[model samples]
Target chain A: MKFGVLRFPGSCDDVDALLAARRVGDAELLWHGERDLKGADAIVVPGGFSYGDYLRAGSIARFSPVMESVIAFAGDGGLVLGICNGFQVLCEAKLLPGALLPNSNLRFTFRQVELEVVQEQTAFTCACGLDGPSPVVLSIPAKHSWGRYYADEQTLADMEGRGQVLLRYAPGHNFNGSSNDIAGVSNERGNVFGLMPHPEHAVDELTGSKDGLCIFASMCLAVEAARV
Target chain B: MKARVLIRPKAGILDPQGEAVQRALPALGFEGVANVHVGRMVELTVEDASQIEPMCQKLLANPLVEDYEIVLDT
Candidate 1:
């Protein structure tokens, strides 16, 4: 499988994401202004300040030429993973549900956080390697300012019922005041996933933890599953 | 035509910036202040009045988390 990592002008983590994807498969960087996805099996929207965070984080980036293609690609059941600012972009583009609000404390926060795999059946997390008890937890680095996830009670309940809620902050690890401790969510189809944590930054244990590799590994299975 | 769009966090949605400002006011010895909310306003000129709503719905604001009101200048 080949992965395509997107690079907006202000994208600081594109290189890191590109390297992380390379660990799993061949990967290349796709420009935000370009219309081609370069025949990638999966698309990774890496985290960083895109379009200077103008209007709102991810708001302007949603309208980029590449995102238009991405929307169509996702609509066709292609695999897409959005991290941090990429998550915000997905929300703005309406490819994912809910909105990422400012942190309750109104400060930028970056630290190690614990996330519970909520929906392991989804394509993005099917190979989490969770063989034990319920609420499987993974330790990964999370870095963001506007990471607070908000969805109304009705919407949250619906998402939960449909297994659209993919990841939750374990115990007291809701660092951004996200509603219901939501760390990540997926589209109803489960093919597109978005999370605020920097999984790309967690691929190596020398820095922090290797638990994030579970997610990317799962994507490998997802691609195989889609083929069959 | 000239228009102003006001965007605010919908009622019941948490406004972190507003809360921080509200907390700072009390520290400055000001009391009796309540329900302080912070919002943004965008001023633009359009060729037609009909363009205001579409602009707000499409780009000026995010309908999911914010409520927008349009005011037209006479």
Candidate 2:
């Protein structure tokens, strides 16, 4: 599988994502201005302060020229993963439901966080062993000022009914005051996934945790599963 | 035409910045402060007045968690 990691101006984690992708499969760096995805089977929108987080995080990056192709790629059923600011961008682009609000503490939170795999049936979490004995917990780093997931009651209800909520902060560890402790969510089709934590940052053993590799591995499995 | 847009978090959506400011006001000796909701103001030069709403809907504000008001400057 080929992974395209998007690089936008002010994006801080593009390199990290590229390295993470390289560890799993062939990876390429995609520019924000390019209208093509370079035939990537899956795309990863890496974490960063895209557009310097001006006018709200991910708001400006959503309008980048490459996003047009990203939208089309997703519409064609290609897998897409958005991490940190990428999650904000996906929400702004309307590829995913709900919005990420400022943290309730009004401070930038940067630390390793525990995430519970709420739904592992999706392409992004299938490697977490959904049918296992207990919930799969990942030690991933979440670094952001606006990471609180929010949505209206009806929309939240629909998301819950559809199994769209993919991950939540483990019980009693909700750091950002996200509603329902939502740490990540998937699009209705489950092909698109967005999460606040930086999975790429946690993929290396040198980073003290390799738990995030499962997320990328899950994408590889999804791609192989689709080919069957 | 010039338009001024005010975008704010919707009611019931948490506004941590505003809450922080509200808490600081009393400590700073300001009294009678009930609540504070911080919002953003955007100024735009547009060709048509009618385009303002669409701009708000498309980019200026996310209707899911924010509400935007547009005022045209004559």
Candidate 3:
């Protein structure tokens, strides 16, 4: 599978995302201003201080020309993943269900977190063999001031009813004060995924953990399964 | 018309910068700072008055996190 990682002006994780995607298969870095989607099978919007976090995290970067293409790509049933600041961009673009607000403490948090895979059938986590209702713990890094996840009560209920809660903060930790401990979620169709944590940072064993590989591998397997 | 757009943090959301400013005000010889919520204002030069809503929706502010209004000059 070929992955295209977007690099907006202030994107800091573009290289790490590119390297992670390459580990799973072929990948390329696509500039934010480029209107071309480049025939990529899957797209990953990596984390960083896009547009210097001006106005709000991800708000400025969402207007980049590449995001228009990413929106269309996600709408067309292509697999799209947004991580950290990328998650904020997705929310700002209205591609995801909820918005990311400032942490209740209003401080930037940078730490390793344990997240539970609440849903495994989505394109991003299906390869983990997490077939049961139980949650699987995955270690990842989160770094953001506005990482709190929020949605209206009705929308939150709808997401829970549809099993759209892809990941949640493990017990005893509510990093960044996300609503209902939600750490990640996918679109209604389950194709577009967004999370505040950095999975690409955990993809290699040498980097301390290889658990994040499941998400990258799952996307590849999911696309291949669809083609079969 | 001269209008000011008020951008304040939505309710239930924390405003650390505002909090820090409020804390520093007493030391700066300012008294009676009841609630110090900081915000920004952008002065716009518009050729058409009908462009307000779209400009606010598209670029001026994020409706999810902020609220804005316009006042016409008397």
With a 3 Å backbone cut-off (N, CA, C), the pairs that clash in candidate 2 are none
Summing lDDT over every window of 10 consecutive residues in candidate 2 chain A, give the lowest-scoring window.
A127-136
Q: Report RMSD for candidate 2.
A: 1.5
Question: For residues B1-74, what per-residue lDDT tens digits would candidate 3 score against the true structure?
Answer: 55556677666555666888888999999998966776677676667767877777877777776777775554
* TM-scores, chain B, all models: 0.90, 0.94, 0.77
TM-score of chain A in every predicted structure: 0.97, 0.97, 0.96
The CAPRI quality class of candidate 3 comes to: acceptable
lDDT-based ranking:
2, 1, 3
Model 2: per-residue lDDT, tens digit, A1-228? 999999999999999999888888999999999998998999999999999999889999999999999999999999999999999999999999999998887889898899999887789999877445567899898888899999888988999999999999997667889888899999999999999998898887888898888899899989989999
Candidate 3 lDDT over A90-196, as tens digits, reads 99899998788778777888888998888877799987655434567888878888888988788899999998889999986676778899999988999999999
- lDDT string for model 1 (A1-228, tens) is 888999998999999888888887889999999999999999999899999999999999999999999999999999999999999999999999999999887889888999999888877787775565666788899888899999889999999999899999988889799999999999998889999998889889898787787788788888977789
In angstroms, the error of model 1 at A4 is: 0.8
lDDT of 2 at A205: 84
As for candidate 1, its clashing pairs are none
Of candidate 1 chain B, the 10-residue stretch with the lowest lDDT total is B14-23
- lDDT (C-alpha) at residue A125 in model 3: 92
